[model samples]
Target chain A: MLIELQGIVKDYRLGLEIVHALNGIDIRIDQNEYVAIMGPSGSGKSTLMNLIGCLDTPTEGTYFLNGSNVSHMDDDQLAEIRNREIGFVFQNFNLLPRASALHNVELPLIYNGTPASQRRDLAEEALIKVGLKDRMGHRPNELSGGQRQRVAVARALVNKPSIILADEPTGNLDTRTGDEIMDLFEDLHDGGNTIILVTHEEYIAEHSDRIIRLRDGRVERDESN
Target chain B: MQFRESVFIALDVIRNHKMRSFLTLLGVIIGVMSIIGMQSLIEGFQKNIRHQMEQLGASVFQVQKFPVQFGQQDREKYRNRKDLTWDHARVIEQYCTAVAQVGPEAWQWGIMAKYRDRRTGPANHLAGGVPAFFPNNGYFIEAGRALSDTDIQHNRQVAVIGQDILEKLFPYENPIGEHIIVDGRRYQVIGTLEKSGSAFGESQDNRIVIPLSTFLKFYGQNRSLNITVLAASPELMDTAIEQVIGVLRAVRKVPPGEPNDFEIFSSESLIETFDNMTRAVRIGAIVIVSFALLVAGIGIMNIMLVSIRERKREIGIRMAIGARRRDILFQFLVEAVFLSEIGGILGILAGVGIGQLVALVSPVPASIPVFTIVLGFVFCSLVGLVFGVYPAAKASGLDPIESLRYE
Candidate 1:
């Protein structure tokens, strides 16, 4: 298993009331798998995504990422894991608006402590992989929505992590551009990369090999496509 | 993250927000400017004073009837004390083993000198002292000759003229063997002195040297005298002074309990007095400068805090990409330091410029010591670090999830 979560619980305090954001969830994901997690507004899907991305620790339970028990790791350890093992693509693109496409892709490598020349080479290769070879010098604001997302995808892929976790990967795109982004994800999955996408849209989940539906912070259904 | 990357990032951000960064730097600029400017002026005064004192000779001290007066507070006490005389000088020279030589000079200022068609005004200084006075003090005879012991013994009417007097009375003619009149007395000029520069805008070279007997003949015999004593070596200056005091006390027959009725002063003592007077002013200026730096540091902190708040999303993105808390903190700290250092450089240039301007227009000398410039950079960097810590920690401690979600 590439990712395994057992008996996870996350609680948030709203005024004096305790709200369960994630309650006793169990999940297992194998390598090279493409999975979609779908839920309504308060279904804890985003919280699950945060956990899988190592952005947050489970309040209670154990998370085994590639057989490493990371649920109770400190912030620096979690940051190391996030850098080396997990890549994140966000709904808003989350690209530094002032940086060029190549530089944006080079961001993870810079934090990875790669030397400057090698960082440039790897970033260029990643950009080329995302079909942005000619647009490497263009800033995010200068690119279209699809091009911006492609740059984000290149940035996420540059580190060669164990898994890619994307939240609302095409929420801001038009349907045609959204489908194009989905097509790119399909190509990434075909290239033997593990991908976990979080979305509320049914059509987006339908393109995945597996879908897990959640309601009110608990799993409602789990099925293969 | 690497240091180079952090600096590049800082430069990029500063360039993006040029106006804001400049405004943030203004306080540091003014603070460092005042520090450098004040230091230059103080250092200049100290240098000039040291030069003047060096010209007066380092291993020599003076014995007078009264202490070196500043604004004349103890007028009655000094006036009532018995005047120091040639007898005391002779006693110091003979009895004080620590003293190398003693030279006594009686002052007769405002003496006009005339040489046929040329003349000098009453502002010329006229001093009556022995030949030992030239060597004991730092005066070196440039041309003809100094007053010999026989000149004083025989009461000869020969004079040694300073460079200013030579220039005034002779102009183009050779002053040696020229006869000059002082208060209707004819005196032959025997030598001309090398030029000595001014101190505190008073010319040092405008003077004439005549025999003590001749001065007494023309100016009178009952006036007070100043005795200059030279120590055998610099290390024995205090010993020499003590020996002179002992001899004078014995010679004057003062009681054991009462203070000696004479004063011993030196160029070093004069320098000390000047330092004491200016110490309070220097401390006050330092306090004011520190307050300005404090305000400047606070301004940097404020701007850094605002910058952190505005860049929460960027911080989040960096954190997600493997940047640890230390990395974020270091980046912000470097940015703050870079800002302050830029201000420091600008302040140093402006301070030096202003110091030079003051030197050009005013009497106080100004010097820009290299150490002060280095100290300015060090101080400004410290300000950045001290004030930068809080904001950097705040940025570093932000929760990655919350920061990512922050608008």
Candidate 2:
């Protein structure tokens, strides 16, 4: 098992009121699993994704990532885990708008304290993986949305994290562009990388190897394709 | 984060908003400029005043009945002093071994001295003193000879003319043997003084000197005689003054432990009193200027917070991509310090320019203090750090997920 959650509960205080964002969640995933977390607005699916990526800690219960207790780590330790073990891709691509594609791809390696010479080599190889070897010097603003997402994917894979966590990764693209992104993720999965995605569209969820449906901050159904 | 990466972020931000950075730095520039400029002018004033005080001589102290008024005073009140006598001055010189020389001076109240009917007085006064008078009291003869004991005892009516008196009385003629009329009394001009300039912080080269006996005969014992004593060395000046007081006590037969009715003053004491007065003024100026600096610091803090707020999504992306919380904090902090340091450097340079300008226009030359230069930059950096803390913390403390979701 690569990730395990034992009845994790997350509560939010919204100005004098307790709003339960995630109530008692239990789930498990093994290596190379392609899982899609599907839900409506306010379903707490995004919250679960954030927890899985270690961007946040659970308010209660325990989460185990690679047999290490994820819920007990301090912010710096969590940050270190996120930098070297988890890669994130967002709907907006979230590439530094002013940064060249090469620098954007170099972000993960830079935070991992990689030496400059190795940083350049790995960042270039990652960009080549996304088919953007020639667009390395172009800033996000100068690139097409598809090109920007490719740059973001390169950035996500640069550190070769244990799992790739993407939130609404294709929500901003056209159908054809979204298909291209899905095809890229399919290739990453075939290469033995575990990928977890959060999305609202069933068509996007249908393409994953496994589907985890969430409703009202609880897991409604978990099934393997 | 590596310092190299943090600096890159700072440099990019500065380059992206060049106009805003310059505008923000303007307040700092003016603030530093004013502080350094004012301090330099004050520093220059201190040096100039100190030099003038030193020219008053190392060992001389003067005794006067009342404070020496720089402005005009009523002649009636000045002539009413009956306590200070020439007898006291002579006895002090005769009995006090610590006193190297004691000279007494008495001057005509309002005499217009003249030569060849080109009259010059109403503005001029006639003073009389002993011969050790010249050097001990900060005077030097330009030509001819000073007064001798023969002139005082026989009332020979010999005179020594100062620079102004020499100019007024003789004009183009040699004043050594000339006779100048003082208060309608004819006296042979035996000596002319070199331009002694402003000694004891006053123009001393503008008065006339005659024999003390000649002065007493004309003006009587009504005017207070000013007694000046020179100690053997500057270190012993205090001891010399105590010894003079003892002699004066015995000479006047005053009761022991009784406060002397006369006052003694030296260049050091006079300067201390002057500095005390200006200290209050300098403190007040500093207080007023601090208010401007406070406003400038607030401007820096407020803008930094605004910058951090606008860059929330950028910060989240950086963190998600791999930047640690400290990396985010370091980047913002370095940016703020860089802004303030640049401002401080420019301000200090501006201040030096203003200081030089003031020095050129002022009565004295400017002597800038090095401590102010170092202090100005250090103070500005401190301002950056103190004010930069909250915003940098805000940048670091941001929740990555929510920050990414923020519109």
Question: Cα-based RMSD of the predictions, in order?
Answer: 3.5, 5.0
Model 1: per-residue Cα lDDT over A143-222, one tens digit each: 99999999999999999999989899999899999999999999999999999999999899988999999887788898
Residue A41, model 2: lDDT of 85
State how far residue B350 of model 1 sits from its true place (Å).
Answer: 3.8
Residues B1-407, model 2: lDDT tens digits: 57777778777887898888878777788888888887787777677667766877879998877654433565455444446788888888887778888888886655787787798757666788888677677778889998888888887788998887777778798888788787778899999887866532345677788888888887786667888899988888999899887887777677888667566778887777667766787777667656766777788888889888888999999888767888888888888887888889999988988889876765445667689889888888887887788899999999988898888
What DockQ does model 1 achieve?
0.69
- Give the alpha carbon lDDT tens digit for every residue of B1-95 in model 1: 67887898889988999999889999888888887888888888888888989888878988887776545667887788888888889999999
Worst 10 residues of 1 chain A by lDDT: A214-223
Error of 2 at B134 (Å): 2.5
TM-score of each: 0.88, 0.79
Specify the CAPRI tier of model 1.
medium
Worst 10 residues of 1 chain B by lDDT: B65-74
